[model samples]
Target: MEKTKPMVAVVDDDPRLLESLEELLESAGYAACCFGSARGLLNHGLSHLDLLITDIGMPGMNGFELRDQVKKVRPELPVFLITGRHEIADQGRAQGISGFFRKPFDAPALLIAISEACKNRDGG
Candidate 1:
């Protein structure tokens, strides 16, 4: 049987970042789902996601809030936090996350981490 691609959901207010991340995740063999807001992602539901990558600074629900909401249901899903703000990164709010990356983060490193997370999830 053929294996399915891992579905990775990304939430960010910036359209450019969403587009870039979607492209990057697709290029790296993940099935990407991009949301402009945390509400959008939450509305879509988390049952199908293999992983999540969200930006810290958003209009309404920030990444941390979104992560907390996700954990309430899909606690085992790997979450990666990304942000352009150095202060938020320094605040040490990245608890219970699989990984954290600053904006303009290295794509190769992100891909490797995603690969590892997906592999681990599949028990491979």
Candidate 2:
């Protein structure tokens, strides 16, 4: 039987970044859902994702709040956060995130993080 395609939700306020992530994920053989804001993501795509890769900076509901909310709905789902700020990494780590990728994150590192997050989500 064919395997199911992995579903990753990529949320960011930056259109360029979101687009790049979608392309990257698609090239990596994952189906990526892109959203411009946390509210949009929550309203539309939260429950459908196998993994989440979100940017820390957003207009209204920031990534932290969004992550917490997503966790509430599905605690076992893996969330990989991306941020340019290093200071908040500790806080995110403390919250039980699978991985935190620094902005301008290398493709391999990001891909590995995604693969790891998928493994963790699948309990493998």
Candidate 3:
């Protein structure tokens, strides 16, 4: 039987970034769901998502807030944070995320991290 692709949700306020991430995720062979805001993601529900990658700085909800809400509902879900601000990375705010990436991160590395995260999720 063929294996199903993991469904990953990518949330960001920037339309360009969302499109870039969607292309990257698609090229990596995963199913990508793009959301313009945290509220938009919430509207879709989290039950079907295998992973979540969200921007740390958004217009309203923000990534940390979104991560907190998601964890409250689904603690086991793997959520990764991406930030354009270097200060945000220095603040040590990434508490319960599967991984954190700064802006202009290596796409290959992100793909490897996603693969590893999924493998670990399945193994445990």
lDDT of 1 by residue, 19-80 (tens): 99999999888899999999999999999999999998999999999999999999999989
Candidate 3 TM-score versus the reference: 0.92
Q: How do the predictions measure up, each by TM-score?
A: 0.92, 0.89, 0.92
Task: Using TM-score, rank the candidates from best to worst.
Answer: 1, 3, 2
| Comparison by TM-score, 1 against 2, better one | 1
Residue 70 lDDT (model 1): 99
What are the per-residue Cα lDDT tens digits for candidate 2 across 1-124? 9978899999998889999999999999999999999998888956668998888888898888888999899898787788888767767677775588778888998898889878877877
RMSD of each: 1.8, 2.0, 2.0
Which one is best on lDDT?
1
lDDT of 3 at 106: 86
As for TM-score, the candidate ahead, 2 or 3, is: 3
Rank order by lDDT, top first? Answer: 1, 3, 2
The TM-score of candidate 2 is: 0.89
RMSD of 3: 2.0
Please write out the lDDT profile of model 3 over residues 46-114, one tens digit for every residue: 999989999999999999999999999989888888999876765654553347888977899899998
